[model samples]
Target: MSSEAKPLSGLRVLIPRGGPWGDLVSRALRERGAHTVTAPLVDFAHTSEEDQLVDALKRLEAGEFDWMTATSSTVADVLTHHNAVIPQETNVAVVGEATAVAFRDAGYHITRTPERENSTHALLEEWSEIDTGDVLKVLTLRSDVAIPVLTEGLIDRGHDVTQVLAFRTVGVPASVHIREDIESGRINALLVASAKIAEEVAAQFPQLPENTIVACVGVNTLEVAAALGLPDDADDPAHADYELKRALIESVESVIDQSDMLD
Candidate 1:
């Protein structure tokens, strides 16, 4: 498409994340003609149980599991940090686009990612199709604060599932300029990917401009945003860059209409 025909031209969007994924998203947005401001509101830290995490990585390298699940890109970073190796025989399932990209970027292969939902439950639902019926050994790495839903679901599916706490999610304070931008409607849209991100957005930008579009990455995140009083204008479970770009386009159009009215 021509520059003028691009969906997100002249739009400024806020991404509440940093690092590889944030950089990737920013690049994608720029390609579609949007200006991106990345102010990470969350950062991952090592889990307190260092010994347990180390032991799990050693076991993972030793090929003790037939399948391993990585729910987020942050978990993939933790794996890279610990030098965790997955044997060739073990299949790795990544939950979302971010995790798949992160794994591939980290020089690991992904066996599967839920084609539709980008969630753990979707992975479990596709288990029979992805694996043989016989009981299999699996290792799941996730944030410390993550619910044990995936582990419990794997157990229910007759797999030997070992759950390991990989890291902890902590809030990162937004800079004063980021805070001021939200209040002044300088950002046309905010992309919220997780409950924690929603909480951070809520905590950091207590009052969002009415014209600011809030888009959630999935239905669950949408619900969480709603509960936190930050109801979203759009949602995409897969958190695709294209979807986020489309949402921003709609917000940009709305902004244009409001400006026309004011004129």
Candidate 2:
């Protein structure tokens, strides 16, 4: 493995993801000697906004959707935990094995799940075997920050889609403790999980040092950073941040060089 792409040894990384997904990223970074902290930038709850998705759920029960894709377990949690029953014949697709497990535990059999490249485009391609007409509504039970790609693609393919807001994702203003870490340089890089997280963070701190390296999970995330006037590269992704770190192991100097560019 390239040295630079290895675990962020001797570096401090901050993750702004919400829910158990954030915990996964934190654990990966810690395995590489990087001290990790998750100051949840967003929070999730199914009850705060049910009306918007209730119709979608009602539709789901009626077998209105052919394939249901849950972006995160939180979405699955919202579906199965509080009286949400996914419709019959609704072949389930999950973004990752973790989410697939959640769907399985919820008593739903998952038909498709991706091991690598966890993104909407990935999910779209994974299920490409199904003809356009076979898929009706691709219900993506996700947060407000969820992008439009998968749903749009399904539409482009002549399939209807319903992206329900199963939960609200809002930033928690940086706490005094977090600000102290940033200002003190205790945090070396701001690893972003989504474009929304990057956009919101940059908006909150416009004068934030351009020096902060944004190690991200995918292209859309990078776009969000660039849109907010922050530097970004193609490798940034929300779902596979650890894969990037592993890739860096073989190219430490290259990563540090990228870090230098951010600084």
Candidate 3:
């Protein structure tokens, strides 16, 4: 749709996810004339929690592990950001090609690349017999946003796991602002990422403006937004900033299209 046809012009949107992902999504929404609001819910920082990672590397250098699963490129960045290097002998498993390329850039040799969606569930489908292999420990390098889902699943299969908090989601001051904005009974749309942020919004706002459409990145996030009483009025999206922003516009258009006032 043309920028002038943007129905969300002068509309307000609440964003609660933190980090570059949030920033990118917000920018896209603003480009469509929506007044994007930020309530930085997740905070990311470079952490030195890779101490054991270094030790793991030491073992790898001494020839220890059979394979390591890199969740994403960020996982490699987390390791190298702390100046840690991988053991040349440790085989690499990655969820995506981007992550595999990252491992290659980091001087690692990838033995397995997950073809399924870049999710642990997809990875597990391919390696269901993970514990049966000589795979020592499946080192899952991840941000705090990673719940115990993967860890719990992997361990259930009898595989040894190492937990490292490569990064964490920090709640910022945006929750308070979003509450005030939404409860003020003015605004047109709400954009969200994780269920955690949506939960905080509900707890703080208690009430949101009627006719305010809620848009989110994934189906799971929408499920959480539903639990927070957002209902089924939002547009479906895959969490990418540009794609979600477009979905948000289309949703608003769909709403307006059915309204007599717009006609």
Tell me the alpha-carbon RMSD of every candidate: 8.2, 7.2, 9.0
Please give the lDDT score at residue 136 for candidate 2. 67
Over 1-263, each residue of candidate 3 has an lDDT whose tens digit, in order, gives 76657745656787664333345456766667677776665555654565666676566556555566655456666666656555656666665444555667776677765454545566667764474665457666666655555567777877777756666545555545456667674655676556666676666555666555566545556677777776443344543243444657454333111110000
Ranking by TM-score: 1, 2, 3
Model 3: how far is 100 from its true place, Å? 7.3
How does residue 184 of candidate 2 score in lDDT? 69
lDDT of each: 0.72, 0.62, 0.57
Off by over 4 Å in 3: 1-15, 18-20, 23-39, 45-63, 70-77, 96-113, 127-132, 143-145, 175-187, 216-263
lDDT of 1: 0.72
Residue pairs in clash, model 1: none
TM-score of each: 0.80, 0.74, 0.60
Give me the displacement of residue 5 in model 3, in angstroms: 7.0
Model 2: residues with Cα > 4 Å off, grouped in runs: 1-6, 45-49, 62-64, 101-108, 132-137, 206-212, 231-263
